[model samples]
Target: MKKIEVVAAIIQHDDKTLCVQRGPAKFDYIHHKFEFPGGKVESGETGEQAIIRELQEELRLDISKADYFMTVDHTYPDFHITMHGYICPVESREIVLTEHIDAQWLSINELPQLDWAAADIPFVEKLMAE
Candidate 1:
């Protein structure tokens, strides 16, 4: 199985977290599912750097810094993933979605209502538990 290293930003602003819906994928399980905004980590890039760059590229959202959060390791039928989560505080919820189909800023309490990708569920659970 292929292993992927990814970073996710739990972008927060005005007491809401940013969730982005993925576009169509080869796998039905993940397609169109909501997820924390981020992408894969490139070789030689730190997890923080990866998140910062990914957010800039994917959402056109600039974040000065990201605090370290928890890491989640999950395996799907096709691939395995080790995801690093970050707590990124932003000034605004505004974003230009270049990759995702839709985006939402929902309170922690409301996060569970969305259909989320399996890999992202752990992050949601942790956030809602807080």
Candidate 2:
């Protein structure tokens, strides 16, 4: 199995967390569902670097700073993945969604209502529990 490293961001603003709907690439399992914005870490790239690049590519914003929040280790039949999650605040609200089919800003209370990626469930639970 291929070992993959991914970075996910739990971006928050004014008590609302940013979530994106899965696009075509992720349409099979829970298509169009909410998830934290992130992608696989590239070769020779750090998790932080991948997250920053992905945020810029997907949201069109330069991430000045991001804090590591959680790390989730998951194994699938096809691949093994280690996802690192970060929490950060963007400079503005003008997000240009280039990859996601849809995006929403939901409160922690609302998180439980939406269907999230399997690996993201624990993070959401943790956030909801706090």
Candidate 3:
């Protein structure tokens, strides 16, 4: 089993949060599922750094700061993941979708309506509970 570490950003703009949809995947469980924007944490980079870099790379969106949130550990049939979540407030909702196939800005209450990646569901539940 391969274990991976990643970071995710709950990017808030005004009253909505950004949600990105994956294009496709080898596994049906995650294919086209919605997820917060972020990616694998590179060597020597903090969770914050990884998130900032990921957002910039994947969305062409720049974020000035990231506040620590919570972490979720999940295991899938093919891999295990330890994901760090962050609360990142952005001034603009504008983004260039370089990787994902779709993007939406939905309020916290409306988050659960979308089909989400398994690891990302915990984050959605937490946000909706707030």
Write candidate 1's Cα lDDT for 34-129 as tens digits.
999898999999999999999999999999989988999999899999999999999987899999999999999999999999999999999988
The lDDT values for all models are 0.95, 0.83, 0.95
Reference-based lDDT, residue 124, model 1: 96
Ranking of predictions according to lDDT: 3, 1, 2
Question: What TM-scores do the predictions have?
Answer: 0.98, 0.90, 0.98
Candidate 3 lands at a TM-score of 0.98
- Candidate 3 residues lying further than 4 Å off, grouped into runs, are none
Better-scoring candidate (TM-score), 1 or 2: 1
Tens digits of lDDT, candidate 2, 66-128: 899889987766677788998878756678999888888889999988888777887898888
Candidate 2: worst 10 consecutive residues by lDDT?
24-33
